[model samples]
Target: MQLVLTVLEIVSPVFILALIGFGWVKAGHEYRIEFVTRLAMTLSIPALIFVALVNAKIEPAALTSLLMAATVGFAAVTAVAFVAVKVFKLEIRTYLAPLIFGNTGNLGLPLAYFAFGDEGLSYAVVVFAVMALWSFTFGVYVTAGGGHPGKVIKEPLVGATLLGGLFLWQGWTLPTFAMNTLDLLGQIAIPVMLITLGVAMARLQVNSMGRAVALSLGKVILCAGIAAVVGQWFDLAPVPFAVLVVQLATPVAVTSYMLAEKYGAQAQEVAGLVVASTFLSVIYLPVLLGLLL
Candidate 1:
């Protein structure tokens, strides 16, 4: 009972904030998703990543292990997704990347902070960083049919990650005034992302929900199972282990839908995926937190 309550306490706010956005959209309010997402990605999220890493009391060895585990876990999941797509005769261009890469940023980071506090956020960021790096590079390549490697370094998320790691390694921080400013900017990221997620979901049109649900479920199971295996294999600590699994278990990102639309793939199919998977997460995430706790 207590554990269930704990999980509820952590998850309720996340869903509530999202529901606010959902309600806002339903009420005919004008929420510009692209502008908000652009702002969050370019400014807020990067700031959050930098500030979180700089302030986190994580050990280098643990960070290294989590990074390694995240890298391996994502690669393995991608391979499995590829095999499944082939066997199931699904379109590789539409489904593979969505299945392999979860929404570690918008959902994972905030959930970690709620579930396991700042320590978990620190751990979650490592996994998020890996996902960001992989998705920007390999995911872009897959989605776009071909992408430039140089584009990876040009991403602010990548730059923030690298800079954050450097600051972490050197035990350095910005002056108090600068740090506070960055922290304030970073604070906008989580709420903006959460609200944007809901707004995006509200706007999505699902063409094939049945297939989307089945494959999305498969993704959740495969990703969580694979992350668990990798976490155990790496001997990750309790918080880090839970963070790894939870991050991987998040729904298919909204970016997948946008990418599919932009690349002329099955955009409606990907939209179905984004909606079904996100809807599933509302029920599943709390259960996952219950178990993890």
Candidate 2:
């Protein structure tokens, strides 16, 4: 009973903020998702990443280890997702990337911060950066069924990610005033992202509940199992290992649905995934956190 409350204490704020966004949208308020998302991804998130990385107290070697673990873990997830789609005779273009790329940024970051503290959030950002890079490159290609994978170069978030890594590696620090300002901007990221997530979900329309439910369940099991295995294989430290598992086990990204819409690859089906997987996460994430805690 005490444990349940502990877990609840950690997880409640995230879901509550999201619920506010969800409720806001359902209440017929104007959200302007595209504008809010643009602000978050381009300005706020990059600032958050830069400040977190530059100010992070983690050792460089530990970051490298976690970085490599995330790289290999993503590769493994991609390979497994591909095989699953092929064996099931599902549409590779539609199912592959969504299965492989989870919502590491929006959901994963805040969860890690709450459950494990600042050190955990620092580690979580490394994994998020890796996943973002891959998702921008290969995830795009898979969804588009053949597009330029080099488009990651044009992303501001990607630039911030690389810049942050460089700072972390070089043991550099910004001036105090500048750092504090960036920290303040960065502070806006998590709560805004949580609310945005709810707003986005409220706007999503799921068309195929059956397939969505099944695939959502499959994603939870496959991602969590694979992350757990790889985290052990790499012998990750306690916080990083739990962060890896939880981040990888996040729900299908709303970006997947947007990609499907853009690429003409069954938008409604991916919407089903976004909805089902997110709904699943409300239950799934807490259980995972309980174990990790």
Query: Which candidate has the highest TM-score of all?
Result: 1
- Runs in model 1 with CA error above 4 Å? none
lDDT of 1 at 237: 92
Q: What would the per-residue lDDT of candidate 1 be over residues 18-78, giving only the tens digit for each residue? A: 8988899999999989899889999999899899899989997899899999999999999
RMSD of every prediction: 0.8, 1.0
Model 1 scores what on Cα lDDT?
0.91
Error of 1 at 79 (Å): 0.6
**Model 1: which residue pairs collide?**
none
